[model samples]
Target: MKQLPPEYYALLEELQAVDFVLVELTLYLDTHPHDYDAIQQYNQFAQQRGLLKKQIESKFGPLQQYGNSYSGYPWNWDDAPWPWQV
Candidate 1:
């Protein structure tokens, strides 16, 4: 079986936190759609998640590029060490 990179775990943790914040803000916005503070905070956190996602992709290759690249360094989805090995 293939192992995930260490950064994968870190990114997953961050993604989870961001997901929670997004969900909470979504619920809050449902009742207070015009609340500027909540909207701003949600936007901020959403941007943070985007940045983290980009970082992960840059380091690990595109998540959806499952076929693996073969030019310089092989984008080894099959052999890229586990999350604990980052």
Candidate 2:
């Protein structure tokens, strides 16, 4: 198996954590649409998710096919299985 830097793993975990929180908040907001606090929390977590995705891509590489995989640059979908492959 390939080994990645510890920080990459940490960032991945943080991203997952943020996603989970966002999911929970979404569910809560669905049932309580008027709860402004939950809506704010959900929006914050969504932004965090986007930022984490950008950070991971900037630090490591693209995590999917849509991220510069075919933008006349080198193909990177198969570059780092250590961080994405299970």
Candidate 3:
């Protein structure tokens, strides 16, 4: 892997945290569908997640592969096994 700025990892952690919250909210909404406050929070967090993703991709590269991300260069989608892969 190429060297990445500290901010990359920081932003990535932020993204992960937000995604976690989204997942929790989704689960909560599944059980408490009438909670308007939770729904609003979920939508707001979802938008924030989108912005963070775009910022990361714009500065570094795609957070995912397949059709979920776009790249101008062939290597933007890492050819190597992902860090999460063993």
lDDT (Cα, tens digit) per residue for candidate 1, span 1-86: 45665767778688778979999999999999999999999999989977876776666655434344332256455555443344
Order candidates by lDDT, high to low: 3, 2, 1
What alpha-carbon RMSD in Å does predicted model 3 have with respect to the real structure?
A: 2.4
Q: Which stretches of candidate 2 lie over 4 Å from their true place?
A: 66-72, 82-86
- Score candidate 2 by TM-score against the native: 0.81
Which run of 10 residues does model 1 get worst, by summed lDDT?
63-72
Q: Give the per-residue lDDT of model 2 (tens digit) for 4-85.
A: 7888889999988998998899889889999998888888989998888888887777765744323224755656464547
Give the poorly placed runs of model 3, Cα more than 4 Å off: 79-86
* Residue lDDT tens for model 3, 1-86: 46677887788888889999999999999999999999999999999999998998888777677777767476656543342431
| Model 1 regions more than 4 Å off | 63-86
lDDT of each: 0.71, 0.77, 0.81
Two-way lDDT contest, 1 vs 2, winner = 2
The clash numbers for all candidates, in the given order, read: 4, 0, 0
